[model samples]
Target: MRILKKILIVLVIIIAIPLIVALFVQKDYAVEREIVINQPNEEVFDYVKYLKNQDNYSKWAMMDPDMKKTYKGTDGTVGFVSAWDSDNEEVGKGEQEIVKIDEGRRIDFELRFYEPFESTEPAYMTTEEVSNDQTRVAWGFSGHMDYPMNLMFLFMDFEEMIGDDLQTGLENLKSELEE
Candidate 1:
């Protein structure tokens, strides 16, 4: 009986530590990355404003070339939605819609994931003119982690997980634009 009590105590401590730590972990997370492309600001902005063009440089879309995709509304308009579904674990299923657009300056997206898990997040892309011939493009995603699920942040990496993909997507965008 004493040994069992001791084992129970140890197990409680192990689980308690992480639970306690999770309480203090930040609930919101954001991932962002930027790249400069030699193309002019308008040129870069025009390319990204059209959601369909994403297939050419989006790292996530590249994950599953055969993934099924569907579109609604106009491609670059504010209500346009691009949804994708894939049996591939990484791609799973998700839909992104243009929530706002700042002409040739910025575009904001609302992202909803439904496959492995379900959540809605905000993402955006901005274009800045560095010079007549150069443009800076920034891409970012942000969302809040819910309750006990946020606890996973203690062990899982937020930046490395999605940030790498964001960075890669930016790099691919740069290359595509410069080409």
Candidate 2:
């Protein structure tokens, strides 16, 4: 039985090591990406303030074209919510609510994901004028994972993964706005 005891001890140590390490690891992650759009800042902000427009540029929104979507309240204002449901695991189910808007500057959204996994995250878009006819658009997403789950951050590059998607969406947005 000493062999069995030693094996159990080894397993416990293996698990405990990660748990201990996770105690010191960061529990939050944030990613931001930006692109230059050949549109006025006001025009870019006006378009981005409407969550409905995301379907035109968001990579995630285009993942499942058949996904069911529903909206509540007005499209471009605070308290507006856009919900989506899809059978695809990656797309899953989620709702994005416009929480705040800074006129022709920034728009903030609260994203709630319910299926496949559950988390409430914050996302935002900002528009700054580069010139009279050009705007710099920045998109950002941030979230947190508690304790042991945060350990996954060690193995996963959420920054690169999410940043790529954000960059793609921004590029798409640039193309849409410029066209």
Best by lDDT: 2
lDDT over C-alpha atoms for residue 170 of model 1 = 90
RMSD to the true structure for each prediction, in A, is 1.4, 0.7
lDDT of each: 0.92, 0.96
| Collision count for each candidate, in order | 0, 0
Which sections of candidate 1 miss by over 4 Å? none
TM-score of 1: 0.94
Q: Quick one: best TM-score, which candidate?
A: 2
For model 2, the stretches where C-alpha displacement exceeds 4 angstroms are none
Q: List the residue pairs that clash in candidate 2.
A: none
Model 2 earns a TM-score of: 0.98
Per-residue CA lDDT of model 2 for 93-174, tens digit only, reads 9899999999999999999999989999999999999999999999999999999999999999999999999999999999
Worst 10 residues of 1 by lDDT: 146-155
Question: Tens digit of lDDT per residue, candidate 1, span 1-179?
Answer: 99999999999999898878778888999888888899899999999999999998999999999999999999989999999999999899999999999999999999999998899999999999999998989999998987667998878898788899988999989888888
- Give the C-alpha lDDT of model 2: 0.96
